[model samples]
Target chain A: MKGLSKDRLWAIIVLLPSIILLGIFVYGFIGRTVYVSLTDWGNDPAQAMALHPVIKFVGLDNYKELFSGFLQSRFRQELVSTIFFTVFFILGCLGAGLGLALILDRNPKGEGLWRTIFLFPMSLSFIVTGTIWRWMLQPQGGLNMAPTVLGGQPATFGWMSSTDAIWKFDWNKLPLLTASVVGLVLAWVAFGAFRRAERTRAVVAAICAALLLGWALFVGPNLHLLAAPELHGFNLALIGIIIAAVWQMSGYTMALYLAGLRGIPEELREAAQVDGATQTQMYRSVIFPLLAPISLSAMIILGHISLKIFDLVYAMSGPDNTFTSVPALNMYLTSFRQNQFAMGAAIGTILLILVAFVIVPYLSSQFRTQEGHA
Target chain B: MTARAERLTPGRIGMYLILLLAALFFLVPVYLLFATALKSPDAINLATSWHWPAQLNWGSFRDAWDKIGGNLGNSLFLAVVSTLFAAVLGSLNGYALSKWKFRGANTLFALMLFGMFIPYQAVLIPLFQFIKSLGLYGSIWGLILAHMVYGLPITTLIFRNFYADVPDALVEAATIDGAGFWQIYQQVIFPISIPGFVVVIIWEFTQVWNEFLFAATLTNTNSQPVTYALSQLAGGQAVSWNLPMAGAILAALPTLLVYILLGRYFVRGLLAGSVKG
Candidate 1:
């Protein structure tokens, strides 16, 4: 036992540098960031935008300011836009990626050549992709002017400057009203699930709906999610960035889907064909469901990238372009540029939690799977 | 992979057409970049952005090379150095964790991997201060350290997963033959780590080379990597489209070329590592 323990100790010693370096750089830095977020460091406008010797413990004031207080209004708006961007980006990438995968999966002409062309963007950095797409989506000069080269009319539309969202409602001041609508949608979904006999999902959804409806109706119009009645559009600017991101990532998802497609044996498709399944019907009913795991994996990857998008937005719109500001960029500007170190840390903490939400469960399950395999 | 009908059916033809259109869609941006890179300043504007350049402006590449060449060199140096450092450390850590059968090693691994999930934003402030305190801030070496530090988790994860595939019997036999830790590593493990090394090299090389945020925050003008340098060219006030496009190509081509040359390992590297996600 002593010899075994000694060997273990030696092993630990051998790994000490990795453990220590990761400890300070990773874990220790996270700890320090959290601590800094609590302190009122670098918040003063008149003070030098550097580390403060006489920093005071502000205790979530920075978070409060960003969330509801009037100082960091742009931050809150940016956060909302990030949500919109991520949701739409994921959808766009999945659709295009899966579509491309399906096309490639048909064993088309010169398949390897086509596959390489599709996946080529996966090789370029976001900075390069962003530059290209920035030029591509330049409102006056980019794809809009393609009409000109063909002797067609020039595009009159603002491709990346349009501010109109596909859908907009004036519920900014009516917070309770928005809650009720959300509650009703949940209730409807729960009701449908109940009809479908998904008991657990129904129960959870019902309870959430009940809580949201109860709060909205009883508490009335006071529970606010926004600091002001700010207009949030799908920012035509984000389309350019989204186009760039999707162009870059669709290839990756396509590759994943191709791998998934290859893993599916040909016998299954033949069986489906024997069942008189039409091509569209076969894909919709048979092939699409089988690609769920690949879809989930692709969504996870795209979600993470969209959340941490800085390079694409930076290269496309530049830093001052608030039309496509996201949490990562906001964190950078607030801390390094604005000198609001604590608030920046707060944003970073929020981003960490956001990333963890996507990653932690995936990792936990991955570890479990590896353990099972071993 | 698909169940081909063994004939050019209308559906197959349609699929080919769709693919060709999609290929053209994907190629347009790269095409624009190259075409714009070739054009003189007056040849490219709102009306002409999509058209071919009037003349091949080889001078723009020269101009771009002159401006961003130094930073590109820095990027190549930092990426190679950091990838080497991180890979070696990760390889050692992986060997110990996989073969040493030590207590607390799994816990240490789990702890280290938690770093992989952390958004780099979370650590920027403290990391900046920490590097400054160490008197290495604003230096290329500081940028390298930052890359190595963040690169540790993914590299360690890859190496660990790779080493875990090795049979226990080999290590046990090595042990019984009086081989010590480093001795077995040198003789039994290091020789066979080429594939694993390739995976980590492709992974970390692309990551550190394309990495911008850490380099942007940690380094000064002399130390700024090519990724940031490319951004500077784009954001610079003068609308010198040709040079920035050329710089973007210059910054982008190394990894792109590496992908073309070692694409099999690169794709395997991507599919194998969910640690990034």
Candidate 2:
């Protein structure tokens, strides 16, 4: 009992400071936010609210307001945009990252140098990426002018500007091309490592190169019409954005793949080879199957990140541009700029549930399994 | 076709080419940033993308520097102070939780863990309101407190995992030698924990430095960090692309330097934190 008392005293001494800080600053703050979301806490809620003393015990009225088709309320638009951005962003990043990783895995001479080059964007904050990409995607910026210099006709379109926005649809004002392009750009900037089986790497490389090159030269040009159809030539903003996101995220995916790759028992591959299994068969049967867990984990993390991505979208889209108005941006404006704190918190609250749905379950299972194994 | 078909051949060149092309594709935006930064605004405003500047203008960097408070001092200060605070407080908390096994130890640990999954965006509005109420709104301390929330989770995770591996026998011996908790922690636990400490410091500093959402939303001028300052510089109409580019390069330098300097440690730390957590 004496020894136990000493240990207990020691625990209290060490624990109290952090508990106070994190509890108040983090968990406590979140609780306050949930409470705030429930009430009319905005700058002039009485004017916006239908009732005086406007605390809507509407339970999920704030959430239901998200589906409200009011032009002033861009809630549903933001939700749809977020969904598009997350799904496409995840697929692009993982796919491109895996592709890059496979190529780099061939034991290239300058592998470290290549790795550093690819990883450079990840180190740059989204602010830097956003600021720089905004400039590059401008009509006279690098993306357009580079082609003109090389004898191609100049692209007289700005991807982000309201006047030159990609979507022509007006009913929903759902800027499909704008959001998709921005998402693509974010993906390119995020993914860097894209690798798979070395044996199939060359074949895969040939197929991917042909597809990418063909897209760049042919399909990419046609898709540019989606950016600013009023302009004669195709706008490459959406494609460029997607490419950037894929480029940035590929490295992260590749890293996961590399970890999974290392985890593969060498004996299985050798045994497959000895059993007259073809190289493709060895990869198809052994390597890919074993990489499923890593792949699933990577997808979940990336998907959640893509949904909550604000920095990249903010950076690339700039505040004034309609294209940058992702769910995060929408929530920020609704709460801070538009002075609709309750509504914004509602969006954030919903976003939280979605992100949790994506990450927590998978992470818990993985961690629990790891603990069991340990 | 069956045996040596797997051997390296002309087909190998295709793999190399694909990687090289993808590498070039990945580098295009970075190259554009560098190219635009070096060029005159006139050069950037031209009808064609200039690969090399007509003349390298170092003056834009000077302008960018002045715009962002002439240096990264504020950012450096915020990052250093906040990171140090997080590391110290977090390590102490983790040691207690792992070693003590008190009545509410598990509850406290779980509470800290809960903060990890809640998106920063969720509490952002209320946090702003709370900060405003305390009159700490738009202050360096506000930013620091907010960042501490982020830094605490990672720092606590690192220390808890690291201290978990430390032998309990050594701690017991210290208790018997008339050493109190602080004395044992300072004299014994700290010295052996230098490597873990380095990882924590570097990780937290990088995160705080590179953050934008809080820095932009929390503070305005007179207390703005470089990241927020860079945003303001680049946010206005008729943007001086060259100057902002220069500002970005300068702003990114510290985080980049830290990452490069601690590349090996950073990678190990990341893998350790992720896998261990």
Candidate 3:
């Protein structure tokens, strides 16, 4: 017993340093950033950089301005672009990764070489990928001239510097749109739960969906975020950024799905074969269903990555290019370059909150499942 | 189950064709990087940018190395020191969490894992202030400290998951034979931890070497890593593309070489990172 107690003591001793460091750096620094975001620390240029400057408490003013202020359209558009980028990035990666993994599962020749070629991009820095892709995507050069070798005319598509946008919407309708989306998602969840015979989950989701949809129909229209219609949409320039991002990240999903595929027992395939299932039916019914969890995990990882992207955009299109700007890059420019510490902190906090929304639930579920196994 | 001779079916041919096309898609930019890097400044024209260089200009690489070679050395020092420190700390943490089985250890580990997913921008402001207050800002050591601190979560996670697979009987047998926590680790756990160390080392080294945001923000020009130097070299508006292309290859070589030599372990690290226990 004495030896066991001593071992426990040693365990504490081994774990203490990491616990303390993480407590301070991860949690404490986050608290400090939140505090800074609530104070006006950089309104005056001279005082902003002083050794110890006076700061005033300004609760939620910075956030309010970011969402609705006339001069902050860049932030609003960036938010819109981020949403569009995340959706398309996830879709592109899933499609391409699943395709590659499915093909590779057929036991093709040179399988190792093919995987190396496909995944080598995942090993490089975003800086290298961005630099190379920037050249390949130049509007007047590289890809535009690829057709000349085939005795065709050079294409004129603007890969990165384009100013066009699509799917434009008025900012005034944002509240309504958000409420409707939440309602629809809850409704879908309730339907799935009902189908699975989970009575409690189904009833709770049904009630939430009803309440949200009713409130949205009755009250959302009056809650306009903008005084007038402000157009925001998916910028065409993001196509270049999205293509580059998908190229770099799709290999990761392919790796994940390949592992998932390999984990399925050979007996399952034989069972399907004995049941007279064709190749396409076998994949659609057996393989794809088993891979659903992997797809969900990949989505969560890829979604968070797209949400906080910085270096690729910065390298491809420098910080001043508003068309391709993201919040991470904007935060850097606002704080370090422009000395707007408070505003920068606000953006950082908002990004943290957005990431937490996606990550918190995933982490909790992951750990809860791990606990069950333990 | 029978060992039948393989046949050249149309389906097989189509699959091979698609794989070849995908391979080409992935390799095109590499070909472009090399082709552009080999061209002379006068020979680099928009019309013929895709064509092979008529003359191999090794001078571009010489020029790039002259500019960013010191920064590459800085990156090497940073990644090595930080990876070593993080790996040691992570192994210790993994041993405690996995073998000790103390109360709240699992909860503490889950909390630590959350640190892995946060956007660093959230902590950038105060972290900068904290480092500056310690008089370490604008130095390579500060950057190394940042990487070590931030890298702990992932490294610890990987090691913890790796060690969890080691049968508890081994640890218990060591304990029964007059071994304490450190003794059991040094005798029974440490010997088996080489694979975990390899995975963590490759993961952390590649991450630190290829990282940009911290390097760009924390360091001055004199202390910048190769990624930041490459960014500055490429971000310029009115420069020859060959210089940045060559610099990209230079910045990417160390991690690329690591990937090529230890790809199996690298892929294991990649899978271990995302597929949480």
Each model's lDDT comes to: 0.82, 0.69, 0.90
Cα deviation of A9, candidate 1, in Å: 4.2
Encode model 2's per-residue lDDT on A49-152: one tens digit a residue.
Answer: 34343554446556544654244334554465566566677788778767666666656657777776666666667777777777777766567776766678
Query: Each candidate's DockQ score against the native complex?
Result: 0.63, 0.41, 0.73
Local error of candidate 2 at A235, Å? 13
Candidate number of the best DockQ? 3
Best-to-worst ranking by TM-score: 3, 1, 2
List model 3 lDDT by residue over B1-277, tens digit each.
Answer: 3245557799989999999998888899999999999998889988899899999999999999998999999999999999999999999998888888777777898788778788888889888888888888999999999999989998898899999999989988887898888888888999989989998999899999989889978899889999999999998878899999999999999899988888887888888777383
| True-structure lDDT of candidate 1 | 0.82
Score residue B264 of candidate 1 by CA lDDT.
75
- lDDT tens digits, residues A225-311, model 3? 878889999999999999999999999889889889989999999999999999999999999999999999999999898988999
How many clashes (backbone atoms < 3 Å, residues ≥3 apart in a chain or on different chains) does model 2 have? 43
Native-to-model Cα distance after best TM-score fit, residue A90 in candidate 1, in Å: 1.0
Give interface RMSD for all predictions: 2.2, 3.4, 1.6
> Which one is best on TM-score?
3
CA deviation > 4 Å runs, candidate 2: A1-5, A43-59, A154-158, A161-242, A370-374, B1-8, B99-110, B165-184, B272-277
Clashes of 3: 0
DockQ-based CAPRI category assigned to the predicted complex of candidate 3: medium
